[model samples]
Target chain A: MSLQRPNEKLKSDVLIGVGLRHQHFTEALTTPSNIDFVEVHSENFFAQGGATQSVLAQASEKYAISLHSTAMGLGSAQGVPSQYLQKLKQLASTCNPILMSDHACFSWSQLNGQQVHAGDLLPLAYSEQTLMVLAHNIDRVQQSLGRSLLVENLSAYIQYSHACMPETEFLVRLAELTGCKLLVDLNNIIVTANNINAAQPLDYAQQWLAEIPTTMVGEIHLAGFTEVKEGELIIDDHSQAVSSQGWQLYRSALERFGKIPTLVEWDNNLPSWHTLVAEADKARMIAEQVFGDNHSSKVTTAMTGLESEFIHE
Target chain B: MNNNDAKKHSLQAAFEQVAQQQQTLISAIFPSADSEVIDEFDPRGMAIYRNNLLATAQQALAISFPTVLTLIGEGLFNYASRELLISSPPKHGDWALWGDDFPSLLTNLAQLSDYPFVADIAQVDRLRQQSMRAKNSVIEQASLQLLATHDIDEIYIELTTSQFGLNSNYPVIEFWLSHQQRVVSDTAEELNQKFIQQSLDKLVQGDFSQKVLIYRPYYNAEIRELSASEYAWLTLIKQGVSIGKALDIMTNNNELEHDFDFAQWIGIALEQNLINHLKV
Candidate 1:
């Protein structure tokens, strides 16, 4: 299987991929076309030798594989675990992912001489001390992996009262300090905005787009979130179709960032492969409209096949 | 307070305050309307976190106890899970090790006490999960050949990789197997002493006592149920017993009922890769 390098340049138009789940492993291997990359959770493939690993290996040969992690726990007070880093290195050496990404939240905390599951991507107090800790963690991760890691912004439910800075500023400062890229998950920003009752969705998007270094935006994530009550949004629910608001945010993001690779995540209640492909087609249309033709040759080649058959005559 | 001391004091104060506000903070994390908090916005915000925590806890429990979840419907299982979470929340960040005490928890629940075998089902479910994720030492090919020469009767043997032990008075395995055939309709009240006695009678006469080795050699979890004769044989092998004495014990006890074939049983064990090594 061909492993895409972390530093490899992406095509101009957003290349769309789905979060590959075990249920869809067979479908992913057999079905082809229009998907620019395939992303899988790193922990799922931690098994030594299994059907899951075999399927991932097969898919990697055909498509660009991006390894997204949930266990890195970059913001942990105790710091990153060396064992996890070693396992990640082994996985990277085996899979050769395009970009390795983890959430900006901590999953572990010290308890009774053992680290216990915090059960949530916990929100951290944005202070100078936290900034330093986060920078050190990111630096260590990059140094250990021998490549720059992309830290995705988190979808928070509540804001810390003592937080001295906004999340956007924290992310920008983080990127500047570590020389790492940012993975702008548009759904998370919307969820954060709703939770805090802070800014309008478009205003938040515009501010983030203008402030963040566009060059450092390595990828984008588009997912569906369900609203359980007023002013509360659950990001990545995967229950319904992508909301119009999310698509609008994607369009605005495309106009601002200019055609980075995008991903459509359907983790729960995953529909048929064709259903996801259809969503990818929508993203392709948006990409074409925003970036135009003169982007990357690979994307152009992919587009030509998809456009003539799936999009236009 | 001095500058450094003041900073430390304030941080400590902040953390204490946050911890003291557990209800509010937990509500923010899990958000259930059923909480004692009176504020409308508190419940709304709290419900989001409540649902999130519940859903995540439920997912962890489901992964750890797939067979248990299969036996009980998702709704009842989820309802039972809430009680378990309240009693014992996850202490670690890894969800894989979350539901360790669920079987015991189920056994103690007053609501589920009627379903006497629910806990045993949970035990099997937990073992299945452990078998899938637990680490095991790999055995070499040469180790199998050396076993034949050793005096198996003189030594005690231990299962290197596959280790699933169960000791119960109730016929839990049989009940589990029966439930798989169809949905269980008997309520706790309906499950009388007479039925229990009848089942126990069947169990003793029909070779109810058994030992099984559960482990993951390649990828998936495997369960190999052992008969009384085979159990004795493996136990002798495990004790570092010489093959001759082990067979002698088996012969003296008349453990093997009619048509006893040692070669066939050994072949099955070899094919299953159960024999790890011989202890000299």
Candidate 2:
């Protein structure tokens, strides 16, 4: 397979992509399409061999691929494993994704004096100490990749009482320190808000979006959440269609972030390929509406901010 | 202290605090005999994370060992997976690399004592997964010329690393492949059931000892059964024995069929990608 360089250009116009799942590989590869890019879990293709690797190569040719990893453990005090980063570097060198991201969480830690991967994205405290660790690890990753990385806010089940700052402030500070950008998942904001029993989750999420500088967010993620009954936690399961509230948050995010590269991620109980693409189409149409109505102030400021050398190519 | 020194001191303090808390949480999740339960975390939140971890482990293992899950069902699989997770918890983040010890876990579990063949089936599944995830390598077709130019004693046959040999007393390939068939149609499901029944019958008859070869010539891993002679011959070839020495060893073995033909075996091995290259 050819190790061609991925398209690094971040479009100033509205761009939408779908998560290219293994089940939808044939349809995505064979069909005539208008989707701008495809995002895949980086760990799934780390093997770099077999049919999985072949399908990823085919997807890379068809669309601008995003390498979103789940296990980079960017906030772990133990730091990212050299072996894991080496494998990721090999995959990145081959696939050459346009964007790579992981959560502001830690999955690697020592248990009973033995290093272990928790196999789940464990939440990190939003403190100066954690920020230093996150920045140190992100710097290590960026230095290894010879490119910038994106750190995403997680939908955490538990919030640390000792956290010194808001999640948005923490992420913005992370970008400032590491020269990385943010993948602001709108669904995660809403899910986290609802889980924390925020009286108005949509309003909370909108405020959360307003805190980050427009240029710091390079990409936006729109996904669905599974809401439980009273006395249960709302899950960022990505099982259903993007909620109407999620769309509203997307609109709010667009009004602020202004036409960033967005992805519609439906991981569980996956819809058909056509149905999945429709979600991306919805995101594009919504972006057009958001930018069409408020083109002067939001668009211009976001454009001016993004045009600064840090966020733009 | 200087500004940079102060920042470094704070960072070290933070690392220690975060590391201590994380280790505490991890110990709670994968508790050992020496584990001390820290009461600082909320019980409800801890339960959510614990459930999520176990669920993730189950899903990951199910992908690697689908036949084992199918045979034992989810309830038992969850129990055994949880047991395995606490004992041999994934050293790395990749779940695919985490379950190499699952077959041994199955063999040692008292709950699965009645189904000993399940362990062997799991062994085959692990090898199949390894074969699928192994680095893709190309056969040195140029080295085939060595077989023709050199004498039998002077030439060594090399097999691809993707090839694995599993010798099971149970009918593993038959039992495993019967489940691998995609029963898309009702008729296919019936045929699969029939094949599974036949295999079970052979399994009960107690002479179904088989040697299984999982070979990956290209992308997908394929499982095939080998006769005693072919397996013995391949085993010798894998031990870096010369073609003549392997043949001589196979011929002298009373347990193996003396009718082992290197000419036919070479043709079959090359076609199946069992032979990587011929070395002199």
Candidate 3:
């Protein structure tokens, strides 16, 4: 079955949003901001009741909610847990999120006959078998949610020897098979390239982005990476500001894919709400520069239902 | 081989290889059986992922067991969390659901032998965390009419799903309350020592046992101390016992200093949202 997009209207504008961390929840709900939407880690709000749901409800009242999960582990051979899907469905029903997404890595595997979560995104080999697993899980999730899922590419630290295809080709095929869209995380591409010692990581990422069909791409994610000592890996820790290289890569993305709803994801060493918003504003300015004035002006229509409800409340 | 059969064999081989590789990589991350699981991948990259898993597990435990962290200090807490993560990695993707084994780990630690109250406090933290995540309850006031209309022997009082009870030998409820502020910075050793001394002093002077009731009456979980008789009464009610039978158990027990007052206890339980409803 073909998965339907969560919102058709979202495709019209160059919308920019920020990952809504808990520190900025009060300000995000209480104050008006320039952002078009707010993306939250779906697992963070998984609790059945109490403050999490209440906070999510208040946040939904103010802005469009994007449910980005880290642990769906769509590439896992063991399959997504039924309880996890149930909780996610309940959360989606509660907020009616504008977008739902998860990483394209496997975090669930069996150890000693017991299924366990690695607690971090573990890289998957680019093979037909892995692709099939991802497609099956994605189809199941889409069927459960009755919408398309946006699968983000992982910044894999290690490479498998027996991979059958390039990451881009694998992702494209995944989208084709499952009718799911891809959440192209630009920084993850650069991080992966740089870790493998690509001569020009930025150019490599642009080349990577060139492979995916533009229509299959749903959203863009811009994040900063942590630079370790020389000879050490540059981790996708999302701690600092987006690098000069990252922006250039993002520019290439906008040039190639046109304006897509983008998110500024700074998950660690979190800055103030103002700083986070400034990062989103920077993304918006870049998108404006790429798509010109009319596209940025169209972003005002992104939060369709919440704006009036927010004002009335 | 035929074309379709050849494709099927190739796909099966690929699936087996991928599954085997993931199992090796995950086992290496937690380092249980094989130390040389990094032969296929870059050792440096594998180490980074391994460290990430430990940090993730540690951070999750810190959030759920803030009181334990504050009481034990950051150094010890991190070490314990890392050890637990290595021994039994998170089975649940959500960290909140993964740390139920943590209090038991605290109980089993040899280093914490001197601080006997630590395990009980950890249990309290776990219960509070569980209570917070418990489904929202609407106390069924309409069902209370069953208590008045039906014979006491036929009536059963149901407690909210969020309610839990813990009976500890040490005065853990007091210790848990005293260490509510979660220390983000490295907890000073001297502070832990001082707290330990105070806890030991309180342990010597305070009652030998404390019955703690943790329940989310509204949005937040509240910890309330229960008398022995009250704890016994609630334990009976929670066991699907009829209200008359529970009262009989409390009344027949000679350990109590005073008589069990069903009316007074019901009033308090209703007020505190401990009772979901009285059913017949």
Per-model TM-score, in order, reads: 0.78, 0.90, 0.89
The complex in candidate 1 yields a DockQ of: 0.23
What value does the interface RMSD of model 3 take? 1.5
DockQ of each: 0.23, 0.70, 0.65
Residue A74 deviation, candidate 3, in Å? 1.1
RMSD, model 1, all Cα superposed? 6.2
* lDDT value, residue A289 of candidate 3: 67
Q: Lowest-scoring 10 consecutive residues by lDDT in candidate 1 chain B?
A: B18-27
lDDT of 2 by residue, B1-280 (tens): 9999998888898888888877877777664545456756767777788888888899999999999998899999999888887788887878888899999999999988888989999998899889998877777889988877889998998788888999888887777877766557887678778868867887788566888899997878889888888888888888889999988888788887798888888778777777778888
Candidate 2: which stretches are off by over 4 Å? Answer: A1-12, A293-313, B1-10, B31-39, B181-208, B252-255
Pull out the clashing pairs in model 3: none
Cα misplacement distance, residue B188 of candidate 3 (Å): 15
- For A92-120, candidate 3 gives per-residue lDDT tens digits of 99988888999999988888777889888
By DockQ thresholds, what CAPRI class is model 1? Answer: acceptable
What lDDT would each prediction earn against the true structure?
A: 0.68, 0.83, 0.82
Candidate 1: which stretches are off by over 4 Å? A1-15, A48-50, A110-115, A227-236, A294-313, B1-43, B70-76, B86-88, B134-163, B181-208, B215-224, B235-262, B273-280
